[model samples]
Target: MKGRGFIFAFLPLLLTTCIDPFDIGDVVNGQPRLVVDGLLTNQPQAHEVRISYSSPTLNTFDREVVSGADVFIEDENGSQVSLIEDTEREGVYLTPSNFAGTVGVTYTLRVRTAENVSYRSLPEMMRPVAEIDSIYAELDSRQSLSSLGTLLNNWGMQFYVSTGTGTPESNFYQWKWEETYQFTAPLAREDQIIQPICYQSGRQFNQLLIGSSQDFSQDRIGRQPITFVSKNTYKLQQRYSLLVKQLSLSERAFNFWSDVEVQRDTDGSLFDPPPSQIIGNMVRDDDPEDIVLGYFQVSAVTEQRFFITRAEVPASPGGPIGGFSSCVESSEPPADGNNGESSGGPDDGPPDFCYDCTLIQGTTTERPSFW
Candidate 1:
């Protein structure tokens, strides 16, 4: 089966089977509806796993707890690891220790319920993928807007992520990126500009996955040059994290009612069936940590630009308006393939680059950082 763009598209087919008279009432009360939400990518890390269940909605009074369910992880070497419940939380189980899943190792999961129903997942292998080397960000000038007689400038940052592996021709991998920003405003202030942004992309099957860069960009806000009084410097800090995961093509089907077998009485009466066979592809060597762990690699850079009243002012004691700090604290040359040049550096990187300005000795109280 072709991989769907969204994971939720599998819900409809997951709930119903091909059996005729699909009326859910034919099943016994309190039939279990299990949901497994985590699938690990080939990255080596520890990830969280969540399994939940709800009673058949059609049968109202059949609600029951899924407690006492046994969950375990199995590796390719026939090693089994048991999961324990979280002390601070209920109904959630976590691996006893962290495990970094390696490529070429197959993993599977086993779940045994209180009612003696069993479910297993097909063995999944972690596929090798590229890792991001660096990310570059620059101001986006196309999104400026004019409002209330003032040319309010909205700021946008474009990102370019470099990977060490070559692009693949087929077998698309899902990518997720998140950014966290911090403002100079007080921690209690709710109006800060920190927010989370995300984007998704995929690669096709049969394609050669090679080392290269993938472009993913997003506009921060609708408005530009956030209008504000001069002289006040706002500090903006941002950090980014990326996650890539390969999904399996085959899906496992399980019976909602699995424990008890149903039969017809001698008087032509029907007995309530037990939970439909809780069936799913048995995962032979499942590793809970790798399935949920997000391979985390982060890179950060910061710049401060100020708004000023006069375009041509005497050189201030602080520094140039568009200058940037050194990428590394030490004097060691930047790492190869690491493009750490600033807009205005020893060679004068870019002309339009302007750094935030401070209150100069002779300037007025209101000094603009960047226009």
Candidate 2:
């Protein structure tokens, strides 16, 4: 960042950076603020709105729960639905399965913490979403160099969604994907397979996609890529299924997400606006200037699901990579000698990490209902 090649004063003019106004170190000096995250959807069954508190600019995921509060949502018709805290989950408030928002209706959330602090969201009208015309998969391949300096061949499938939007007012949309795949792990004891099958499901993370049709002429997003799977990984080794949720966002919600996209894309240069705190419709009723992080909105959602098997990618020039993860299986007995081994007492077995696939985050032995 130094030297004569680029002027020091012009550094901000070249490229922008993505950092909140406060450095991470300021977290200890800053006051904790409320983080409101969730949405009211038309298809909602026991919908949840999470309330937690955390100061900004820290690299920690620990957020204190704002619990023991009265939470409820009021519809434009003046009907109020109370939310009860989930005894099983901290900071999560849930509504009845029958409680679902309706399209074209505005809803506002109100919360009064046990500490007597009150916060509310501006009434957000439930927007309308375009239905997905179709979802298709395309087998693709690419080459790259591995860290081991070897040529790598990768194959995968790219999933896309098609939409038909003839209306002009419905110009903003958001997308999120949930993928579940079956992984079979062969657990062996002493050379013979003890558990030949282990089924686990996983959900995709950080697959963010947003589109605004304001610029295009009447035509909505035709073919938008949702997610891709690299064949080199174990995800595509067996059967895989994906769920795509298309959400209709109000112009305000669209703009909020757009700013998030911009801040994520910038490098803190003059070309980009200086990084500032991004807050949504949630505000404190007690203090007007108090900054609350996160947003609450009502959205109409349409979802589509796609299923694919290894046989679908026929052109890929390789055999299936079984989902078995590489790990050191010891023939020795456990240090505690309490583990139930075979009659001989000391049989070779896979480690708990590999044997119990649930060790992986977000994995469950209970298969998804759709699968």
Q: Candidate 1's residue-wise lDDT over 284-370, tens digit each?
A: 233332221001111111122222222222124222222122222322212212122234444542222112111111212231222
User: Which lDDT tens digits does candidate 2 get at residues 1-371?
Assistant: 11011010111110111111111111333566777766788985888888777644454354577889899999998999999999987788888878889999999999999989999998999987889888888876668788999987666777888774777554677676777777544343456455333244444333346676676666467668777677645566568888888888887877765555555556867888776556778899989788776677688999999888877766545445433433333433222111222222224345554454444444457766787
Clashes of each: 60, 6
Cα shift from native, residue 263, model 1 (Å): 37
lDDT of 1: 0.32
lDDT of each: 0.32, 0.65
Cα miss at 159, model 1 (Å)? 3.6
Task: Give the Cα-based TM-score of candidate 1 against the true structure.
Answer: 0.41
Q: In model 1, which regions exceed 4 Å deviation?
A: 1-32, 40-46, 55-65, 138-155, 158-164, 167-171, 186-371
